[model samples]
Target: MIRGRFTIYLTLLALSVIFMLGFFKQMFVMDVHPYNKDPAPRGKEYSKDGDFDWGTAVKYNPKQKLLLKDTVENILHPIAPEFRIGDALPDTVVRQIHIATSWRSGSTFLGDLLNHNMGTFYSFEPLHFESLSMSTERRLDLMNNIFKCNFHNKEVIGWMKHASKGENNFLFQRNFRSFKICENLLPGKVSCYMDKFQSPICSMSPIRVIKTVRFRVKLAEEFLKNDKDFPHFKMVVLVRDPRGTMHSRSHHSWCSGEECINSTVVCENLEKDAQSAYQLAKKYPGKVYLLRYEDICMNPYEEVKSLFEFLKLPRSKGLDNFIQKHMFGKESKKHPYSTFRKSDNIYMEWRKTVDMGYIEKIQKDCSIPMKTLGYHSFSSPFDRDNFTISVLSKASESIWPKNLS
Candidate 1:
């Protein structure tokens, strides 16, 4: 009888493995192509469609293409510094600041805050050149040096100067035109880019803040690693709760006809990113600041004050008021484009919303780094071993029971 039972158990286990493999293979590999009966004219693959396809292309908005193109042009055709034939070069000292963050992590708000002060101008996502074009590393190196005042390469500087003139205005025009073409393309009515960078306020700032929100951390790492000679550069990393972040990201993914929660890649990537940011912060103590979204939302004034101090900027008028007005509060409604907006309301909501089973899986997979981020304990009943278990137990009694009923 014992022998017969063992054989049955082994057979069942083999079948179970096969079933799981097949299920996951189908879940991940199945492709769903959009059905556009009258296909719109294709520009460069992944380029902006001049003719709009209302149904299919709403989420794949290409407003940033103009900005990117202009940036490239600026690098290629920089204008010569205007100095009379034999005059000495003007001693203009320029400082560069890089604001790096994972997408949708309030880097925009931080950038706006900095732009409000002296010696700060906002450059949106200059690091995306790596994925957008070939020879990204070379371009990034040239641009980095040009901004740093160590740009001895006259050819590169001339190219950039020529590029900056009409390029900035051209980008603004393109983005505005694109927005008019499809009003629903971007969720926010006021393009913060338009509001912050285009106005008279932007012209007053002297220092430049390059705001980038690439999902990958390696992009910034590569730039920093390569440009060791660059001086007086500061990097600010903005982070948010992964649960809220992923929730918002998921909605955006769905609108774009992509799967968000289907893959565990984002969670995995964020864990790696957080660790990278933490390490960078540790390595460059004074130069790097890790700003958390939750902390910012909770006490906007305090956080903004700290940030201004870190950036060596003065406490400007209406700074606190601006933060208070925009800070995520109880009265705010969930943004149609981002579900994470809803999740933002619940502090530590991951414990409440995530399924106990999935939470256990994530905890098991990411325990080491999660603990490193102060999310775990060494002793007591709710230590690392029982952290998820305890959360699950509490959730089971208070959170999930009503839903099940």
Candidate 2:
């Protein structure tokens, strides 16, 4: 009987130890090797001869070219001294630009314009890999790693895959030609070694633009303030009129909730962002630029010229051609998210579509941001519908409110 009891106790203890060991291993693996699953093995006789259809649902302009062309030409442009963070950045360090804006703003168009410039490595929304479970610090860390081209980091490798693969293949649309080359080399195999190829290409570029609507200006300000790793940082805070943004967001079903379309919430965020942007601009001079979407739409050529001048990047013929093709080109059935805008006046279409009640609420809820950002609120249907009357006030020209200290 004593031996039986002792044996039972030992068995229970062994089972508990095994359970604990497995739990710890899982936690360790999640922390260290997040993407531990091995890709399926490819056949030894694999060849690119088949009529393997490239996956459908492609969005970018290089239509039907699943195998992206490798036309990346690197241009070494002089960095404007005013845009430097503090001390002179080393020649090896590239200009790091972060476009901080909210969804439905013209950030994609703005980002695409910059990406069209030669020698630019544009990383579109690295935060697409972000989870609600992740803390703010983790998101900032991921941005830092990606901005620095630290693709070799174990965790960042997982994030890069998430941000670039599957439906997110837009990463290869304009920039990342090197990554495209690596991806096509093996067609359907992991042997192309994307992880080994991305960092070198990204780092070799003379400029890296990280365009993200996921990050707020306050968080970006904190990133610039805290992260000492990058010195050649330039932040562009892009904002649009609340009415236009909300109207645009309404087109997408995913863009819902208080954070997405709520007039009060949207303007609150914009107000806060404006305050932060103003302070950042004052603190960091040419390092921070506040760009209004309406301003860009009003006069794209002038705005583009000012933008390029601010960054000290030379105005390239490619960018000029891109703007002409996308901004003024013929309209067609396009992906809802495509940067192709047939006319600049499309931004004003909201005035025709949005109901007066909603406009009233938006004007009421967003009054502070409206006033601060130089947007004119309509008191009546006549004011709202008057094509002769512009919603943009003259104060917007400065990109800063007069009262901002």
Candidate 3:
């Protein structure tokens, strides 16, 4: 009787232990490894008579492969795992983009567009604080370090480091405009000494974008060479039709302060800018985006959508609404620095604003670049405006396509 009773008790205890273990297993999920190494898909390259088009981006995606793999994994194990936000950041890659543009190429509009993206640490004309004073090699070296996020160049890096509460009395002007750094610092927020300079940079959104008209796209080849750099760098070269670009430059007093009356000046600058943009796009397939200002103004919705897709940022209503307010509809909210011109007419405003005599000179000097860029060689300014009209009729076609050979 005693042996039988003892056996029954042992069986009950074993069963109870098994039941408790099963209950605890169901209640909690333990993920020993929190990071995912699966990389997202990238836009592919295609030859479109030397223009970057939507077809490649539309069809090829590196993410699609990851998506399929994940689907299969899920199907194999029919249980869904609970996700913890804190540890999930390693799943995404942080992107660092540089907008390499020339003077008066609608870069301000582009800058504002990228600035609106969530978790973007955007700086305008970061090199404006220097460049003119430094040698070409020195300036390039300084830029190299800044893009690398290692403050090695004391002269320029000094400008990026010192911040103040009021109009910064620092030598670098606005680099550290709102913050007084702590004498000693820690890794996280506890180490931060000020709030005004405290930016909303977190793990999930780790993109640092600096828009500069200073650095040419050609100078950025070094950063793109590295596949394993800590802060991965990408570049987008923004170009504008020289007629408009030069006219805008003249209006803004940008072309060497002399009378920039010659179209050769426009031609020479456009040649350099176009070559840099074209070479970068060709060399770095997914790393370089050749964005045209006229294109942006033409179909802002699709243009910006491609840009955002390249940046790996999700679409925001704020950006969409901004485009609607600025680029779409009958009237746009005028920018302080920008002239009041309709988006459609603005790209061709050079026809009206520029001197007629300069047309022949521009055509002579700039015909190759103009044709290469798909800008029709105008026998006269009338053809240019008419060409602009035809192009605007189908805003889907971009003149400075990234694939332009």
Which structure is stronger by lDDT: 1 or 2?
2
Best prediction by TM-score: 2
Candidate 2 lDDT over 1-405, as tens digits, reads: 533332333333233223222222222111122234653332222235421112221122233222222211111112221221112223334578899898888888898888877657788776767644467887787778767777777656766666555666655554644444444344432322344345645655557888877777877765566446666678888989899999989999887677887888888889999888987878766677888888887778888887787776767667777877788888522677788886568778899989999999998998888888888888899998998888887555565643331
Question: Pairing residues by index, what is the TM-score of model 3?
Answer: 0.62
C-alpha lDDT of residue 323 in model 2: 78
**lDDT of candidate 1 over 1-405, digit per residue (tens):** 533332333233233223222222222111221122443334221236432232232223244334333533453224322311112122232335677676556665666666555334455444333432426556566456434433234433333233234333322222232223222222222222222112222222235566655534545554444334434456666765444455455546432321234325545665676677656655545556666666665556776776666655556566655555455434444554221233234435445455555555555555554454433322332343342432212211231121211
* Predicted structure 2, TM vs. truth: 0.74
Better of 1 and 2 by TM-score: 2
Off by over 4 Å in 3: 1-92, 148-153, 157-205, 230-232, 257-266, 329-336, 339-341, 381-405
Q: Which regions of candidate 1 fall more than 4 Å away from where they truly are?
A: 1-93, 127-139, 142-204, 215-230, 254-264, 328-360, 376-405
Model 2 backbone overlap count: 0
Q: Estimate each model's TM-score.
A: 0.50, 0.74, 0.62
Q: Deviation in angstroms for 73 in model 3?
A: 28
Error in Å for residue 167 of model 3: 9.4
